[model samples]
Target chain A: MGLIDNINKLFDHRIRLGIMSILMVNDDVDFNRLKELLDVTDGNLASHTKTLENAEYIKVEKAFIGKKPNTKYFITPLGKQAFKKHIDALEDLIRNPK
Target chain B: MGLIDNINKLFDHRIRLGIMSILMVNDDVDFNRLKELLDVTDGNLASHTKTLENAEYIKVEKAFIGKKPNTKYFITPLGKQAFKKHIDALEDLIRNPK
Candidate 1:
């Protein structure tokens, strides 16, 4: 195998990658904003978000915003570490090709 | 939404991403080399390689080496451009936090 072989399979999807990419920069991202940013359907976003949630790579918060339900996502420490390691693996493969 | 909307869905899988990363630096890669480098099952590698081939992102070559069957892969110009754009989008997202 290459220098780094293990790449987290969780962020292998485009939607999940989009979610992580956005969350890496923003501390808190609302459901609507994530949907908008990823340009994914409500179902699509929810399904992928659920996967990340199950993996505990992200945390979700639900609250009432002036009588309206609102949900937001934040990357956890574990999530950040995993994401960074995944990126490092990619970079390593890019730099060294066997 | 981020500056780049499309991130090339073809590379959303870890195996496919690995294939592209390795092919980016090396001009030609044999099937056994990829199989060993990625450490993927024979079926897994073939399936994913077929996907990339269908997308026209990679080209495959079949030959005989000393009476042994062999196969190789190379990235096309379109694939190189797509991979570069995909990486650029990732770096852009990393640099800019919306």
Candidate 2:
């Protein structure tokens, strides 16, 4: 496939891209932290996270920290593989441009 | 601005991204060639190229070669600088992840 074909559309959005980029290196990230990191509103973060979760790119776990709700997200194995492919395609486009 | 903020929304589309990538390397490219390179339909290519042109990221020159009308695209200085900044932000996001 061409480099353009390999560039995943899901990661095209800045919010989604930011979410995956954060998840790629970190073990797991919580809701509030992701919001703060991406500098996005709660609703914006929630919606994008839901899309990633639906794609199975990221998995969410809900827990309680002293009775307070905490939602944490982790990148799945598939997510990591797919994101790596996308980044590789971008790098290839920059280096080769064909 | 944050890395996410630095990522240009105009380049979020694969077609537009492809167009800029090609223009960044080539001195100039014609309409049909861009269509072939991007593997997009004429309308698709036209629309994306128009978007770039509207942004002043690219300029369209009209002329005739042997009575055949030709439209060529060249990246503007502003476009080059903006694209470079966007790429740099992506690289920073990959390297620093913050």
Candidate 3:
């Protein structure tokens, strides 16, 4: 496939891209940590995470830590594969530059 | 600046990204060539080019080649710099994966 064809539309948004980038190296990330790392508001982070979740790219886990709600996210196998393809396509675009 | 901050919002779209990618290496590209390369409709290409033009990232030239109108695009210096930065940030994101 063409490099452009490998660029996934799901990661078009910067927030989503950031989420995936963080998840790629980290085992799991929490909601507040994501918000802090991405420097986005709670609502903004929530909505973007929801989009990733809906696409099954990232799975969310909600639990309680000493009665405080803790929400964390993990990149699914499909997410890692898709993100790797997207990054590879981007690198190819830079290197090939047609 | 953070790697994410280096990612330009203007290049978030695949079409726009493709346009810049082509312009980065080629001296100049005509409208039809860009349309063919990006595989986008005339209207879609026009709108995305307009956005880049509005940002002053690209310059448009209009002429007639034997009575047939031709539109061509060239990337500005500012555009080249910004695109380079964006590409560098993407590479950093892949390499560092923070």
lDDT of every model, 2 decimals? 0.84, 0.90, 0.87
Model 2 lDDT on a 0 to 1 scale: 0.90
Which docking category, incorrect, acceptable, medium or high, applies to candidate 2? medium
Error of model 3, residue B67, in angstroms: 1.2
Question: Each candidate: RMSD to true structure?
Answer: 1.7, 1.3, 1.5
Ranking by TM-score: 2, 3, 1
The 10-residue segment with the lowest total lDDT in model 3 chain B: B1-10
Candidate 3 segments exceeding 4 Å error: A1-3, B1-3
lDDT of candidate 3 over B7-69, digit per residue (tens) = 789998887898999999988999998888777889989999999999998999999999999
Model 1 scores what on Cα lDDT? Answer: 0.84
TM-score of structure candidate 1: 0.92
Residue-level lDDT tens digits of model 1 in A10-84: 877767877887898888999999887777789989999999999899999999999999999999998889889
Interface RMSD, model 3, angstroms? 2.4
Using DockQ as the measure, the top candidate is: 2
TM-score of chain A of each: 0.93, 0.96, 0.95
For each predicted model, how many residue pairs clash, with residues at least 3 apart or on different chains? 0, 0, 0
Summarize candidate 3's per-residue lDDT along A25-72 as a digit string, tens digits: 999999988887778889988999999999999999999999899999
